[model samples]
Target: MKLKNILIVVNDIELAKKFYHDLFGLEVLLDSDGNVIMTEGLVLQDEKIWCEFVNKDIVHKNNSIELYFEEKDIEAFVEKLEKLYPKVEYVNHLMTYSWGQKVVRFYDLDGNLIEVRTPL
Candidate 1:
């Protein structure tokens, strides 16, 4: 068996699509009604549908998983993120590790954790 796309629940499908595209450059590969498949194998599902399927309350900031992305210019990415989404809650601002890898961690619009780091 092969691993498929990573699915995340979003309260607003259209807003989620635009958020992912604006921040991560992920375009919609397909829009299947309540489900949207985007580039890099990311899937956005409607929150109502997700809750019904899981039969549980949706929790935000669970911190169980994070979608990671690598960028050549992490500083520019962080600036863009701030300019575009000022209200974003950051787990950590851009910081460099001892090994010189810079990373920024923040939550997406729907509370999905995201970490953007400079290429190692």
Candidate 2:
């Protein structure tokens, strides 16, 4: 089997929805009283990632998940991300490594690291 949807615990549901929508342009697949679902491609064809915000004794912490967004213009994406999430930092300048690819990295909401890569 392949990996599927991932859940993120967020204290602010509205902010999370806005961030994800603005950053990645993910459309809302389902929205209820307390749950918010968003997806990119066909549910079974691609991954059905969902972000649910509940009012429980939940520990709002960052998981070991690194979300990556491939961008043709990494600089423009970075600019938009920075404006939305002020805590975003450039992990390093875009550089071609021995692996033969160029990449840049940054942090997203909840301090989860994200990488934007482009093949050279």
Candidate 3:
């Protein structure tokens, strides 16, 4: 089977929608009352409904998983992010590894870890 999409449970659909679109330019491919599918195979679901379906309480602020993205122009992307979210918390500011890849890590509005890295 082919991998399709990654679904994330979000507290506020509208807030998450705005955050993803503004930050990553992920266009909405499909949208309903509780779910939204974005361009890059990302699906955002309402936490309440997700919890109901999973039969467990939704956890927040955990660092166990991260949504990763790669950018060709990582420097420009980082500059734009810094300007847009001046006060946003960062897991790590822009850094280059010995392997010659640059990466930045930060939390989304719902406290999900997100990393943007250069292609290796």
Candidate 4:
């Protein structure tokens, strides 16, 4: 089966929406109480509801996984990100890998790891 979407558990839906929209320019496809679906198959769900549904405690800052996005112009994207969010935590600041693709990593508002990279 083809992959569908990624659901992120968020502490606040409005805050997540603003962050994703302002930074990545994702448009809201659907918005309701405690849930929002944005462009590119990104879904934000309330953490309390998520935890209740999954029967597990909400965990933050788990750095084991990352949401990755490919950018056409990584440098330009980095410039915009830096200008808009100067205090964002960066795991790696604009580095080229051995494969020749440039990438930058950072944490989201809720400490989820996100990476943007240029195609090799």
- Best by the lDDT measure: 1
Q: Local distance difference test, per candidate?
A: 0.94, 0.60, 0.90, 0.89
lDDT of 2 by residue, 19-104 (tens): 77898787778766545767853121111222222333433334456666677776677677767776766667566678866677
Tens digits of per-residue lDDT for model 4, 67-91: 9989989899889888878888988
* Model 3: how far residue 81 lies from native, Å: 1.4
TM-score of each: 0.97, 0.64, 0.91, 0.90
Candidate 3 lDDT, tens digit per residue, 1-120?
998999998999998998899889999999998999999899999999998899998777688999999998989998888888777789999999999999999988778889999998
**Model 2 stretches astray by more than 4 angstroms:** 1-4, 41-63, 89-100
TM-score of 4: 0.90
lDDT of 1 by residue, 5-110 (tens): 9999999999999999998899998999899999999999999999999999999899999999999988889888999999999999999999999999999998
Candidate 3's displacement at residue 77, Å, is 1.2
Give lDDT for model 4.
Answer: 0.89
**Predicted candidate 4: what Cα RMSD to the true structure?**
1.4
lDDT of 3 at 44: 97
* Candidate No. with top TM-score: 1
